[model samples]
Target: MLLKVALLFAMLIQIGAAIIAVSLIRRTRFNGSWILISGGFVLMAIRRLFDFSTLFGNAPVFQKEEVNSWLGIFISILIFVGLIYIREIFNLRDRIDELRKENESAVLSAVIQAEEKARQKFARDLHDGLGPVLSSIKMGLSAIDLQSLDQQNKLIVQRSTSATDQAIVSLKEISNQLSPHLLQNFGLTTAIESFEDQLLGNSDIRFQFEATIGGDRFSYQVEITLYRIVSELINNSLKHGRPTLIQLSLSQQTDMLCLTYNENGQGFEPDQLSEHQGMGLENIRSRVKSMKGIFQLESAPGKGIHVTIQVPAK
Candidate 1:
């Protein structure tokens, strides 16, 4: 009977040691629950050793067999409870990560929608405020040309007319930049081609464009967001990169649409910039997130920059 008790105690000690070792290894990184689990296993091991030693060594122990059995059962319950808690901790961590991703996506969508609304408002204001004012100035100048005005007054009118024309042209450019009319009339491809042509005519930098868009038509919001993102990237390259060559490409495969750009210019570390800090970069990310898309940037000092965006066609 004593030998059987010793063997059973040895088995329990081995199981307890294994549990303690696992818990200690898991707690090496300072996890509190693992430490607690290890403590529970240690207590069970000590209780089993005492019970076996008293049975084998002819010691007159105070505790009865029933009391020792109850104690063992209690420690076993504690170990089982600790394991359940550890499982719950892991599950909670996974849920927190998922929630964080969802929250980020929500915030990005809100920002992009807000920016689009602001752009539309600015376009409307320019049309309503400056467009009519310039038109009136032109009419006034034409009326003066038909009147018997002095030479000096005629020159003043001519100068005023020239100034008004210049103002009108500036306003038109601003309106177009805010929201292109070609995007509404033609399509994303035509609007992009027009942008490329305009950039080539205005800048010394070489511009290259390649597109293989196969979609029938995209929503206005999608087209505007994409156009704004591309335009911002071009502007950034011009102002900061000072690249001699710029390449823009677009394509679609299955349900995924892709836009990529590369510039041979001085580039900076992308990791150092905050997502919501740079206006251009922020807008690009916002637009991508709004479309439930992925945005990636590859850049290093003096190496150049490459941006790739992919979105599902809906």
Candidate 2:
């Protein structure tokens, strides 16, 4: 009788475990391992039930054992209570993992913000401090009367004035590249288009920018991170990939903002890239993670490179 009770209790526990595992399948994202565990529990319960049914060898003893029947009922109730605790344990674990990711993202976001602040300060100082000083030097040169000077002095003054002008333009360009004023005043699309214009004027690379979201604005973090990512991608392509053509597209899908970039370049295997070759891609991945976004890269030797990123618009 005690043996029969033990078998019945084991069957009850197995069935309870099977139910719990099956219920957690969705919570575990239907993981294959969890599915197999659930199946194992179900098979064990079935096997135990078969053994318990045949324990009496058709003597009809199972129904006659009233004390064993009462014990099975008590065990079933205990297993039911235990399943609830098991589920709560899984929930607590998931919550802790979520909190950990949130903490990491928060730290990364803080670091990026601080870096951007530094860039802005430096750009502002260059524009406000050095910009005017260079302009004053150019103006003083412009005020010189070249007519009264000899031919040699006139030529020297002309060269000096031209060099000063070039220096002023180069300084402004540097300041703009460090911290884009258009990105601060205009939206992301406008800023990207402005960058594209500069590239088109300076390089042989054919660049394209398309935006389905028009001029809609996102959070500052999203805008700046995306802008930096685009810049880095282009720089990588020019310096290594040697791409003649680059295309970028931006769109809003549901609650997410999607970005797609491609370059017709000499691509290399992403998995086999050296540390220096992979660093840019890794930086892009980290930036996406900081925004809690998804980043995907596809590249192969001679196949060109493609990248996709999606982040929450909110």
Candidate 3:
């Protein structure tokens, strides 16, 4: 009966240790607690085994018997406390993670909504300010050209025409940046391709883009969020990384959408930098968090940087 009780106690301690180990794996913050709990349980199990062996063997001497009994009680109490504390720590970690996720979702919703409002304001400004001004200039120039004029007046008309043309170009650029017409008319893939072509023509950096979209449609907010995020990433690469070659890949794997970018540039340690140090990276992180996505960065000194993001397909 004593042997069976000892074996049962040993099994319970082992079970507690197993549970603590699994919790440690899931909650990264409880590593030290797990180690202490696991060690204590192991010691208790060993002590119980020793106690069982002694009981089944030649009787222990008085001195050894008294020492064993005291040590066994001490170890058992330590093991029980350690297991309970570890469990409490695990619960705390889980709660923290849950709260963090909720906070991120709230922040993301605010950011995207704010961006949408800004875009609308910009579009309105272009239509109201630049659009009408350019139209008036074009009409006024046509009126001037129609009148009989000397060579000098013709040159003035030509200059006015050139200025109006430049203003039109500027307005077009502003409009495109505020809200890409292709994005509203067609879809994200086409808009991205158009932007890529324009970027490649203007910059010397070589960029490769691939899209393996699962479906033909996405929410307007999602499209805009992804567009801004990608734009920010590319801008960061250009400004900091100075990479000659950059690759961007987008695809859907099952129910998750993935975006990955790799650049051949000098990379810095992410842990070493403060959150506010890189506005571009911070923006990317915020955008990813808003979308309830997973963001990861891999980089080392003298090595290039790789950023991978995954979000659930909604």
Candidate 4:
């Protein structure tokens, strides 16, 4: 009698579990797979009810062989359906991850573009306003008649004129760096070449640029982004490392455009980018990721820095 009671209790618990499963799943989508799952649970509950009836009543409605066969078929169907449910869950998870990445990239891309627009506007303001004003001041100083002044006054005027000239030159250089016309008009390659030439001719720093790309240009956004990244790297190398030699390469392979840069100067920990990374390095990383491009950085304390980037033609 005790054994029979225990069996009845176990069967009741299983039926209850099945009822819960169906109720929960029914709250979700009603598809073929869900129907199979829900139906399997309902069938299991009904099968248990029939078994319970035999324990309490005089005779069984179904024979043991008949009940066993139905249970086997139902179990097989449930197993198959469970596998499909697991696979569907995995597929849905993968799709969600992909959508998340796309949304992140879109947000980052918008931020980088907004920053570029701000830089362009600020550059224009400097070039059109302060730059011209400074030049005019230099010219006015140059026009001053120092010959008619006393010796001490003439010397003061001369020194002031010299200072004004230097200031004008500095303003123009800063304005150009902010929004280079070459980058907008000539594309990335030529703009980079011009930058290299200007820096090399004026400063003691040495730059070697190699390009296998043709005159065909990337999209304006790509060209400008690449130019900004390169410029930041160059400035960092010059300011911090004082690297005597910097090497840059540009080439096209398959559907990708590649850039490789190396500086023969004291490098920093690549891991420290998060701690000490200024706007420049962070911007470079953000821009690359936003474009769905790959960026590789290798550096150590005593060694030099090497960076490689691969961006799609889009």
**Cα lDDT of all candidates, in order?**
0.80, 0.85, 0.78, 0.81
Which structure is stronger by TM-score: 1 or 2? 1
User: TM-score for every candidate vs. truth?
Assistant: 0.75, 0.74, 0.67, 0.76
**Candidate 2 per-residue C-alpha lDDT over 1-314 given as tens digits, one digit per residue, 9 for 90 to 100:** 99999999998998898789789999988765566556656665665676688776675665546545654565555456556656777898999999999999888888888998998899999989998998998899899999999999999999999998899889988888889888878989999899888866688888888899887988888889999999889888987898888999999999999999999999999889999988999888888888899999999998789999998887
Candidate 1 lDDT, 2-56, residue by residue in tens: 7866668685876669576665765478665666566666666666666666655
Tally clashing residue pairs in candidate 1.
0
Off by over 4 Å in 2: 1-83, 150-155
Task: Kindly list the per-residue Cα lDDT of model 4 for residues 83-194, writing each as its tens digit.
Answer: 7986898899999999999999899989888887898899888878887787888788788888889999999888888888788778777777877887778778888998
Per-residue lDDT of candidate 3, residues 199-283 (tens digit) = 6668788888889883476778777778877888877777777788889988988878788999988888877866554878888
lDDT ranking from best to worst?
2, 4, 1, 3
Candidate 4 clashing pairs? Answer: none
Model 4 bad stretches (over 4 Å)? 1-65, 198-205, 239-244, 272-274
Residue 232's lDDT within candidate 4 is 84
lDDT of 1: 0.80
